[model samples]
Target chain A: MRTVTRLYLSNDTSARAAGAGVLADAWSEHPEVQLIRISSRGAFYLEPMVERDSPAGRVAWFNVTAQDLPLILSGTDGTPVRSIPFLAQQTRVTFANFGETEPLALDEYQARGGLSGLETALRIGPDAIIEELQVSQLRGRGGAAFPVWNKWKVAQQARADQKYVVANADEGDAGTYCDRMILEGDPFRLLEGMLICARAIGAGRGYVYCRQEYPGAAKTLRAAIQKADEAELLELDGEPFPIEVVEGAGSYVCGEETALLESLEGKRGVVRARPPYPAQSGLYGSPTIVSNVLTFATIPNILSRGGAWHAALGTERSRGTMALQLGGRVKHPGLVEVPFGLSLHQILEQFGGGMAPGSRFKAVQVGGPLGSLFPASQMDIPVCYDVFAKAGAVLGHGGIVVYDHETDMVDLARHFMAFTADESCGKCTPCRIGSVRGREILERIQAGSGTIEDLALLHDLGDTMKVASLCALGGRAPYPVLTAIEHFPAEFRAKLRT
Target chain B: MREQVKSVLARVRSKPPNILKALLALQERLGHVPTEAVSEIASALGVTTAQVAGVLSYYPDVRLTAPGRHLIRVCMGESCYANGCGRLLRELQDRLRVDVGETAAGGKFTLDTMSCAGNCAVSPTVMIDRDLYGRLLPSQLDTLLERYK
Candidate 1:
């Protein structure tokens, strides 16, 4: 009997964008080759990366095209997947299932330690689950860095007939794709995480408010939810815990927990004033547990492998691994899940493989669009929440976008302001109007028609937006601009009218 | 148009009556939500027309006006911006003879921008309808555009 060959390819959004779909179609045409689709290993630069199971383990072929099918089928040219420096030199907790199995395959998911978290949660119960989370020292991965157990505790304590577990998959941040990666790749993991959260919070129903931009993730999640429901994996105390996938309509502000609840209720994605926080009153005046996709994705691991196990990694305050996305002008732009304390310099140099050839790193904008810009001089700062905070920067959403020497800091500042102005919900004067004024001033400075007074006015505007704005959208909008001006003063000064 | 909107709205069976979902469903089925169908949608979703209009206007996804045959969304996200997506945008504007957020003269393409679609690894990404094209160059715009028409 002749043995058939099995091949693996990434179905990740980035991989597909890099032309995995076309390659998969080409490979499928062959009768001898059995094609299997799995999630990306987050080594994005090498996508359309194909892997074949060898006696030595899974060997990979990088940046494959439809034309490379013959070479891949022959299994003549490839490196062991784990041997790749990008894949080997990192700790993957949340994304461990990535590149291992087909995203929706429940059997494969369970075979590789999938439902053990839910099983643990079921055995231990809600109070113990919260205790495990507290021990884990896990903070919200969605910019805020708030303690995960605190929010779960509030919702678990709150008295409500209809409570909710909402996973904020509205990853609108420009340079971030971790949430999308989780949702698209190992969606069952996210479902398991949400199920555990529901079990902890005493919630009957859950909703994943995924962004409209990620249609693929939403579709994948919906399919995963259906699969889990059929397998009876979403049951809490022998009752069906229904989880629905709700799509966000391109609103950046909706990423905020309160605003997300508002949008989930089918209203405009406007920022809601606090006091009755989502943990207390959310999703139609009911107690809700709103957490980021990464945060929820992390819960399963913390549950399965004791919280102390997770706490063992990382710094004193920020525990466990963070999925850091490296994009823009980097040689090996991809995602790195590491214990939080590695310097930006180390991450950029080691995992990122430094800057792209012929390009020198000017600055890196950590977090997201609202994240602060750090010069090469500040690259030594450790990737800790407190460390980044002390440096007057945000570790928001763990998106690090590097800019080369060709980038104009002044124009980049203006671009951030423009994004804020465009995406602002217009509910507040500071974000809606101040953002526009900030853009105009930056434009004037860029055109060499601005005086020193305009710079001061820009600072004044930023300060007001920081303090008075309703939500993070308005409040944190000035971060990139202010940080750009502070770090690259010469660039801003050069743009001024002579 | 009213019947089409009603049919689309009827499909949305969520308990709380999702206005966003209804609007999205309507847009998905009809290409664009018609003004005439607003009343039907409002009634079906148990919302006032003003409320529906407010939601319709708030989101960038749901459209009030009909888009061109093919929709072209250029990602203006930080990663793409850093990789010279501006040049690609300019080339697209020249080739399509349309500015950002406007439909081309012949209605072949509608040029618009998304903050990000999380495809930053392949910077300077563009989406024509549902098909995503990445690592794009300004010189490649003409050839890419030729596929849709």
Candidate 2:
């Protein structure tokens, strides 16, 4: 047999625009080299990442360009990426095969323990599967850290003629890309995860509700679903289980479960009142399980590596690893999946290598645009669901967007409110009206035309919106505004001056 | 445009719940959904034109009017904004002579902003049509724009 060296090409957005340049060069010259396009390594700083599978093991190069093609084709040893402490040190249960394997190659995925979870679920059955999730203490990674198993248990018990499962890939969180990476890179992982969910709930059909913004992820996932279908991997319990990919028509509120379901059913993406929670009566009035892509992506690991093993990894209550995306002013911007107890200082300074050179770090907006803005004083705070909540912050999606000293908090806060106002679904009064009113107040301060009493009014409005809004989009629109005012009072006060 | 809409809706299931999908399909084939097609799509999907139009208008990407030759979407996410989408958008407006949510006079470009493109690692990202450009600077505009036109 001829020795074929496999070089992995990442389809990540950052890599897609940049990595394609090098891939074109490599393909033109080296036809013999088996160039495999894979998902992101989670660590984006090393993107346009190429992995060389050798007899010795895997040698990977990060930040590769077309200029590196000659040296790569020369057959000389490339950088051993796994040896890098940033990758080697962390526990990579969910993201284990990320950027390392061909995204949709079924045989390759199988060899690397891909569908083992579904196989295990098929063997142990739904009750045991739900039990495993409960024992694992896996909470939803979709901003709301609700227990994962509870949703599954409800869907399992709900006596509906047809059951549905949806992977919420509408990742509108500004600073987050892990969901995109999973959908694009390790798409099958999400597919397999959803497959596990289907087997658990006896779902006839599943849909990956991706945002239109992620054209790349949608394309990649579609291709993966096709590959999975061709491979006969779509079957569960000997019944043909089919999955479809639905594209969101650019509505931020649609990231909320009910809105996503409404969008999936081909309606105007609007928030539906809960209590008949998704598991109780969802999609076409059938019992449905709506999970974030990351939540589904985590299912494979829990099933393969027993629930107790996953439960032991993180802090009490919050179990397993979180895929933290470091963006903005950070020197090393990428995805880092660490156990839940790491502090912001460790994630920023130790893992992120701090802010870019000469730039003084000011604050980090955790979760997404809706997440609270934290000052440097709160660096020691651990990034867990409960810890962040106690500090009046949310660990929504675990996205850390750092800002330098030069950033205007008042302006950023105003911008976030403006974003909320722009994306509001016009469902209810508080979110629809309150977000615009909040932006107007912040803009008045930004224009130096506001009163000192305006701050008190903003606070009151924030309280009302928080209490009355129908969903998180409306409820949490006040988070950035209130937190910016609380943490950087001087910035808002300074804006009040001419 | 009527025939085009008819053909697009022909392939769709014509089910009540599939109004959004049919509209998306119609928009994909023809740059934007025509008003004439609304009644046809509504009839096919067994809904009123008002219902179809209501769902159509709710989405930001769905347009009543056709797009320019090139679509330029600047990401306004926290990372992109923090990295300088503000300056980038201003520079783009100055160079293109069009503001966000508007197209230029020549029908060459449509400028828009997204909450986030989810490519935050490469902050300050912009998407010109199908291709995404990351870590964009104002100076790169001339060369980047030349490729589209």
Model 1 agreement with the true structure over B8-118: per-residue lDDT tens digits:
777885788888888888888889887777778787878799998888889988888899999899999999988998888898888888899999998888999999989
Give candidate 1 misplaced runs (Cα > 4 Å).
A1-3, B13-15
User: What DockQ does model 1 achieve?
Assistant: 0.84
**lDDT tens readout by residue for model 2, B8-127:** 888987444588899889889999988777778888878888889889899998888998999999999999877989999999999989888899899999998888898899878999
- The whole-model lDDT of each prediction reads 0.90, 0.87
Cα lDDT of model 2 by residue, A1-498, tens digit: 655555777767778765555475657556557777677776666677777766667787767776676567665658777677667777787888887776767788889998898889989999999999999999999998899999999999999889999999999999999998888778889998999999898899999999999888899899999999998989987888899998988899999999999999888899998889999999989999998999999999899988999999989878899999999989888889999999999988777888877789888899898998888888899888888888878899978999998899889989999999999999989999999999999999999987788999999999999999999998988988898899899878877754
> TM-scores, in order shown?
0.98, 0.96
Identify the candidate with maximal TM-score: 1
C-alpha lDDT of residue A483 in model 2: 85
In Å, residue A487's CA in model 2 sits off its true spot by: 1.5
What are the per-model C-alpha RMSD values against the true structure? 1.3, 1.9
